[model samples]
Target: MSVPGAMIRCMDLTRFFADVDAQPWADLHHAYGSAADIPDCLRALAGESEEAASEAISELYGSILHQGSVYGATARAVPYLARLAGAGYRTEDLLVLLGGIAEGGADEGDSEEAACRAAVVGQLPLILAKADAEDPGLRRAAAWAAAMTGAAEQVLPVLRLRRKTETDPGVRAELLGAMAHLDPPGTAADATAAIGAHEPAEVRIVALLACVDGGLPWGPAHHAAMLSLLPVNDLVEGRLDLERNEPLQYVVEELLRRDTDADRDAAYTLLDGALRSADSEARAEALWAAETACLLSRSAPERLAGAVEAMVADPADAPAAYSLLAKLGVRAAAAAPVLARLAAGEGDPADRALEALVAVAPDRAAPLLARDLGRRPRALGAACGFLFGGAAGASFTYDPELLDAIRTRLAEAGGPGADEVVRLVNLLGAWGSRASAALPELSAVLSLCPGAVPKALVAICPPEHRGTTAELLTAAARTGPEEGRLAAAAAVRELTGETGPLRAAVAARLTPGGPAVREAASLAAGLGPEAVALVPALRSALSDRAGDRNIPQMDADVEIAAALWRITGDPEEAVPVLAGVLAEVQPMWLRWTFGRAARAAARIGGAARPLVPALEGLLTEPMQIPSAVLALHAIAPETLDGPRTAGLLLDAAEQDADAETALDALVVLGPDSLTEDGRRRLIALAERDLRVRASGLEPGIAPADERLREQAREAARTPAKP
Candidate 1:
C-alpha cells in the first residue's frame, strides 16, 4: 500500500525471498539497474518501487566491510523493524543478528556495526522497560524478550516488583510466565524468597511453580507451615500470611522422596494435619501421605512407642493415635505392651485406646483382643472382628469371668455402653460360628434391648446363627415401628446368603406400605434375582410420597433401579420409574437417583439411550444430575450437536435464574453458536457470574455445572494426533 499525495511515496509490503532461483535478485537487478549504485538503491528502497526496496535490502545484507554502507542505512532502519519482532518473528534468528552487533561487532569492526547495535538496543530497551505494562500482551512480549536477553538482574527485579503491584491479572500472569524461565540472579534461596513475596493469585501461583522447580530445600518446618495453610479460601493474599506460607508443594514431594529424618518428621506432621482437615480431599490425601513417613521412620519401634505415649497424654490427637497403631501393625511384637495397656485402660482415653489396638494386635495378639471382647465393653462389633482375626476359633480358652461380665452388662439397665456389649456378642456369634453357646444371651438382647442390637445381630450372625436370628427378625420385622422394620431389613440384606429359613425370613419382610420394608426389599433384590420377588414391592414404593423425610424410600428407588438394571438389562424397567421419581422427588434425592440411574444405564451400554431425554432435562436445571450429562456426552455427543440442542441450551441459559446454569448451557452449545448476539449475551452473563463468584454471594451449583461444561468443551477441542 502506498501513501497518497506524497512527494516520495512510502509503501509497506510483505514478501518472501528464496536463494533457490538462478537469478535470485532478479527483481532487484531489473529495478535498480546494477549492484554498484547502492546509494540511489537505498533511497529507492524507501520509495514506493518494490524492485528498489528489494535491491536496497540485499545490498544492505552484502556489506560486511564498510564505514557507512547499506549496513549503516539499515542500522537507522532498526526502529521500524522492531515492531515486526513484537508482532512475531523467528525470535532466535533475530536475537542472533542483534547479538552479532552487540557482542561481536560482526560488520568487521566498522563504526556502523557499533551504531547499529546502539540503535537496536535503544529500541529494545523501550520493549524491555514495559515488562510491567498494564496491557497483558505487551507485558508478556516484553518479559519474553527480557528472558531471552538474559535479564537476570535488571528484568527479574522489575518483574518481581510488578508481580506484586500489578492489578491486571493477565499481565501479571504473563510476567510470571516470563519470570519463571529466568534464574533470579542471586543465591537460589534468596531468589525464591524474593519471588515468593509477590501478590495476587496469578503471579504467586507462577512464583510457587518456579520456586518448586528451582530446587529449594523444603524440610519439616517448611512443610508443616504449608499444611496449615490448606483449605484455602483465597489463593494470593492468603499465601502472604505466615500461617499460610509453607514449603512449596513440589518441594514437599521432593522431601518425601529423599531419605532423611527431616523428611520423615515433615511427612508425619503433614499426614496428621491432612487427616484432621474438614475437607474430604485433604483427608483422602492424608492416607497416602503416611507412606513415606512410615518408610522413613523405618518402622521405628521407639518412635511408635512415643506416638502411643503422645496419644495417651493429649487424648485429643485421634489421628496420631491411629497413625501410631497403624504403624505398629508392622511391629507386631513390639506393639504388644502398648496394645495391652490400651486394652486395659479404664480412664478418659479408654474408648480411643480400644479403637487403637483392635487392628494392630497380631495373630497371637488374638488373646489380648479376645480378653477385651468380653471385659472392656465398647464398640463390641469391632472388638468381635478383632477377636476373630486374632484368635480364630474354640482354640483360645475364654475366661468365664469376662463372659460373665458381658452377660451382666446385657442384663443390667442399659446405657449406650450396655448396647455395645450386645453388639459384641452378636459379633462373636457371627465370627465364632458358635451360635449354640450364645443363642440364649443373644435372644435375650434381641427381645429386651433397643431394636438396633437385634438388627446388628442379624447382620453379623453366621449361617448357623442365622437360623434363630431369622426367626427373631421374621416375627419382629413387621411388628416394630418404622425404625425397627428398616433395621430388620438391613439385617436381612446382611444375612442373605444364610440357610433357607433365613433367606425366607428376609423375603417375607419385603412388603408394601412401609418405606423401611421396601428399602430392605430393594437391598434383598441387590443380593440376587432370587430376591427379584421384591421388585413388585419396590415398584409400588415408588408411588409413596417422595420427599426429604423419605430418605430411605429414595435410597430404595436407586437400589431398585440398579437391581432391575442388573437382572433384565431393560432400560424400560429402570428409565420410566427413575424418570417418574425425578419428576416428583426432592432435589437432593432426585439428584442421587439420577446419578445412580445414569451410571447403571451407562454400564449397560447403549441400553441407556431412552433415558437420555430425562437426563438432559435434569442437566438443563444445573447440578441436577450433572454427572449424567457426562455419561450422555460420552455415549451420545451427537445428540447435543444439532440446532435443536443449541436452541434448548440457549433457552435454558436465558430462562434460568442461576447464572452458572445459563453459562453451562452456553458452553454446551459450544463456541460455534456464538453469533454476535449470542456472544454479547454470553459475555454479559459471564461478567455477572464473575461478579457473583467474586462477592461470594452466588450459589456454586450453577458455576460448578459450568466447570463441567468447560471440561467437556476442552475435551472436544483436543485433536486426535499425537
Candidate 2:
C-alpha cells in the first residue's frame, strides 16, 4: 500500500491513531449525542475491507457532518481522515468525505467549523498531490476536495496546472467548477475561454455556468454555447456531480440569480428553444427549468405557458405538464382547452388533467369534474380548495350536476375511503345551504366519518333542520372517538351555542397529555365567555409542553393564550404569553407562530399595549407585516407611522413577496391613510393583468392573484370621508 504521487511520506496506520485514545471522546459531541463512538468509526475507516470502510464513512457522515451540520467531533476526526487518504486507504471515498466536511463550513464565530476548515487546509499538500493521480476518478475527487479547502491561492494554481494536461472532460469540468468557486471574477475569463467549440460538451456546460456565476455579460457566444448544449444530460452522463444534476435547470438558477428582466428573458429563450426541440430529452429538461422559471420570474408564466402547453400536447409528457400548469394556477388558463380534452377522456392522465383544469379554470373544470366524480379523487381534492388545513382559494363553483355527483358518491353503500369522504364532505360544507340535498348522506356517515360529517352537516342544515342537526351532533359528541367527539361538540356549539357538550368534550381532551390539546384549545377559544368553566384546564394545558404534541410548543402556547383571553377576558394571563412567543420565536417561526401570536395579541386591544414593541419589531419582516399591522392598528393606532406602514405594505404588494397580506393590511387601513400615490398604485394593481401575488411555487397562485386584485379594487373604491 503505497501512494502513487505522494509528495509527503504517508504516516503508519497505527501512528494515525497514536493520539486517538488521549482525546476526551466522551466529552465531545456529534449530531447524535456523545462522540465516544467516533473513535471506532475512525478506526473502521482505516480497515482493509472496502465494504467496511464505505459503511464507516457513511456512519461518520451521519454523525459528524449530519445533513451538512458540523460538530465538535467533526474537527477532531479530520486529521485521521487525511492520514487515511494520504496512505491510499480508500483515497477516493475519504477525499469525498473530507470535501463534504469542508463544504459544510461552520456557522459564524463557531471555532469548530473554522477548525474543521483549517484542519483540511493543513492537509492541502497530500490532497493537492492527488489532483495529479493517474485515476481520473481520484483526480476528480481531489479537485473537488481541494476546492472545498477555500485555499484558492494554493488550490487554483494546482488546478490550473492540472487543466493544462487533464484529458478527462469530467475531471476538467470539476476543475473549472473548482476554480470558479475559488474566485469567480478571476476565473470568468478562463471559464469564457473554455466555452469554445473545441472543448468537450461537459467542459463547455460547466464553463457556460461559470460565465453566468461570474456575471459575465450574456451575449451571442454564451447564448450559442448554451443552446448548442441543450439536453446536456447525454454528454455529462450524470458523471459530473454538478450542484443541480440537470444542466438546463442549473443554468436557469444561475441566470435568475442576476434577477434582471434581461436574465429572465435569457432563461425564457433557453427554455423556449428546448421546449420546441425535436429531442425529447431536451424538452424534458426544459420542463423542469420551466417550473423553476415560472416560480421565479413574474414574466415567466406568460412566456412559458405556451411552451408548456406544447409539451402537454404529447400524451407521454402530459402528466408532468399538467403538474406545472396546476402550480401556475389561473396563469395557465390558456391551456384549459387542452386540459379539458384530456380530462374528458379516462384513467389517471385524464384525472391529472382535470386536476390542473380545476386549479386554472375551475368553471371550465366543474362540469368535467361533475361528470367524473367518485373516480377522480385527486381532482376532487383540488376542487375542495384546501391544502393540508389552510384554505387555498374559493371552492369550485356550485353545479347541480356536481352536487348530485357528490351526493351519489356519499350515498353509495361502503362508498369512498375516509379521505375521499372528507373531501366530498368539505366540498358540501363549502357550498353551505345549497348542498342541503346531501344532508341525509352526511348524517348517515356521521357514525363512520364523524370528524368530517358533523362539520358539513352544520354548514348544510338550514334553520329548520338545526334542532335535528344539534341533536345528532350531541349524540355523536357523547359516543364517538376522541377526534369525532371533539368535532361533533364543536359543530353542536356552532349550531346552538350549547356549552355543555363542548365543555365536556373540551375538558376531557384538555388534559396535559391529551393528543388533541391544540384542537381543544382552538375550540375553547371559539367558545368565548361560554367556555369560562374550562379556564383551569386551559391554563394547565398551556404549560403542558408535551413532547409528542402535533403542533409546535410555541403554537400551542399562542392558542392557549388566545383561548384564555376569549374565555376569561383576562389580559394579564394572555398578553405575557403572546409577548414571550413574539420575543422568543426565530425568523423561521414568522410564517405561522409569530403571525398567530401577533393576531392573538391584537384581540386584547389597548390591554395588549405591552405587546406593541414586539408587534412593531415584526413590521420590518415582509411576511409578518399584515399580522403586525392589524395588531398594531388594534392595540396602538396612535403610535403607528401611517405613511411608513403604508409605504411598507405598498412595497410588499408591488414585489409580490407578501402581496396578499399587504393588501389585506391596506384594506384595513382604509383610503384615508393612503396617499394619492398609494391610491394610484392600488388602482394600478387592481387593473394590472399580471398577478400581484405570484412569487411562490405553490399551486394556488392564480386564484390568490385574482382574490388580491378584487380586494385591491374594493380598497380603491372605498371613499375617503371629508
Candidate 3:
C-alpha cells in the first residue's frame, strides 16, 4: 500500500483516524438526506481492501460531491482525503477525488464551495511534492490536483518545473494541461514549442489544444500538426483531460469562438479531413465536431452536410448520422435518399432514420409513416408536432394515403398505445373538417379515450354533425373522468356555446384542492359573462396559499384572475392578482406564467393601468418586450416612446434574442411607429439570407428562421396609420 522512496510522506495514520472520528459527521448534509453514513464511507477509504476503498470513493462521490455539487460534508471530508493522498493510501484515486472537489467549488463562489477549495489549497505543499514523485501516476494525479486548486501563484511554478523533467508522454501531457489551466496565455510559448515534430503525439495533441485555448494564431504548422495527428484519440488514450476527450472538437470549438468566416472555414476543413479518415474512431470524433459546428455557425449546416451524410454509408455510424441529420433539419435534405433507404430497411436504427427523414423531408417520410403507421411512435410524434418548442414535420399536407392509414389505425382493435391515440386524434384535429371521414372511428373511441376524442370531434364535426357532436360532448361532460369531463365541457362550449350543464362541474373543480384547477379556470374564462356564478369559488381558490411557491399554482391563479375579469369586468378585483403574479414570477425564459399574467393584464385595457409600471419595467427584458408593449399600448399608449421601443425591438431582432416577440411588437406598432432607421432595419431583416433569429442548434431552427423572415416581411408591408 506504500510507495518506495516516496518524496511525499503520509500524515500519521493514528492521528488521522482519531481526527476523522472526532468530527460531528452526523450533523452534516450532503445531496441525499443526511451525511451520517459519510463517516463509515470515509473510514473505509483507509481500510486494507482495495475493493472497499473503491466502493467508499464512489459512495462519497455520489453524496458529498454529487454531480459536481459540493455540500456541507464535502469540506469536512476534504482534509481527510488530502491527508490520505499525502499518506500514499490510494494516492491516484484520492488525488483525483480531491481535484474534483477543488474544481467543483472554484466556480460556484458560495461559502461551502469556498471552504471546499480552501481545504484542498491548504494541502498544496503535500500535493505539489507528489508532482515529482517516482510513480508517474502519482505525478500526473498531483499535477491535475494542484492545478484544480486554482492557486496559480502556488501551483503554476511547480507545474512549470515538472514540465521540464517529465519523461512519460502521458505525465508530460498532464503537466502541459495543468499549466495551461493555471495560465493559458502564459503557457502559449511552451505549448507552441511542445507541438514540434519530435514530441510524443499525446504531448503534441495537448499542446495544440493549449495553443488554441490561449488564442494563439493558428497557422500552417499548427494545421499540419493537427492533420498528422488524425485519429489522435488512441494516442492520447487515458492521458488527455476529461474535457478534451475529443481533442478535435475542442480545437474546432475554439476556432468557431473567433466567429469569423476564416476561422469557420478552418474548422470545417479540419472536420472534413477527419471525416475522410479511414479510422472509424476518427470519423466518429469528426462527426461530433461537425454536429457542434452546425449548431454554432450559420454556414456550417450546408458546408458540413455532405461530410455528415457520408457517415450514414457506414452501418455503425447510421444512428448518430440520423440524429445529426434530424437536428440539421432542411439543411440535410441531400441525405434523404440514404435516410429513406435506412428508414425502409428493418433494424434497430430504422425508426431513428424515419424520424430524421421526417424532420428533413416530411413529404418523403409521410408515405413511409403511413405504410408503417402502427409501428413508428416517434416518427408519428414528430409528424404530429411537438407540444413545446418548434419542430418540423408538422407541415404534412393533405395526403390521402396518410389520412387513410390513420383512419385504418384508429378503426383497428387495440391498435396504438394511449399516447399514440392522442397523437392520432391531434393530427386528425389539425386537419379540421377535411378529416370528417374519420369521425365514425373517433365517435366509437370517444368513451374509451374521452379526453382527446371530444376535442378532435368538435374540430372535424361538420355542420350536419354539430348536434351529434354536442350530444356526445354533453354526455361525456356529465359522466366521464375529471380530465375527460373538463375537455368535453370545453368542446361542448366550443360547439354550442352552452355552459349550463358543466357549471356545477367547473364549480367543483375550483374547490382549491383539485388537480384540474387550471383547466377549470380556463373553461370558466371561456364562459365569460355566463361564469358569474363561479366567482366566489374562484376567490376562495385564489386564497388557498398552500402551494404558493409552485409554478403551476401561480399559473392557476393567473387563469382564475383572468376568468374573474372576463366574468365581472372588475379591474379592482382582478388587476391586483395579475400584478401580484407578475411580481412573484420571474426568469421569463421558461416560465409561461409571467407572460400569461401580462397578456391577461393587456386584455383589461386602460383599466389595467395599475400594471403600467410593472409592464414598463418589463420593456427592458428582451423576452418580455412584446407582452409589455402590448400591455402598455392597451393600458397607456402615451407612456411608450415609439422611437425607444422601436430601437429595443430592432436590437432584439438583430441578436435573435426573442426575435419572434420583437417582430410581433413591430407588426402591432405598424409602419408609422417605426423611426426612419427602424424601417430600414426591418427591411434589411426581411431580405437577409442569414437568420436574424432562431440560430441555435435545435431541430427546427431552419423552419423557425424562415418563419421569422416571413414575419419581418409582413411587418414591413403593414400600412401606416390612415
Query: Could you give the candidate ranking by lDDT, starting with the highest?
Result: 2, 3, 1
Cα RMSD to the true fold for all candidates: 24.5, 4.5, 4.5
* Selected candidate, larger TM-score, 1 vs 2: 2
Q: What is the lDDT for 367 in model 1?
A: 46
RMSD of 3: 4.5
In model 2, what lDDT does residue 657 have? 54
TM-score of each: 0.42, 0.85, 0.85
Residue pairs clashing, model 1: 226-246
Predicted structure 1, TM vs. truth:
0.42
- lDDT (tens digit, per residue) of candidate 1 on 193-239: 53443444444444444554455554443444445545333343322
* C-alpha lDDT of all candidate models, in order: 0.47, 0.80, 0.80
Worst 10-residue lDDT window for candidate 2 reads 386-395
User: What's model 1's lDDT at 174?
Assistant: 54
Candidate 2 residues lying further than 4 Å off, grouped into runs, are: 1-11, 106-108, 234-242, 328-341, 344-346, 360-368, 386-393, 496-500, 544-554, 576-595, 608-697, 700-722
Candidate 3, residues 344-452, lDDT tens digits: the string is 9764467778888887888898898888888887778777775113342236555678899999998888787788888888888878888898988888788778788
Model 3 whole-model lDDT (C-alpha atoms): 0.80
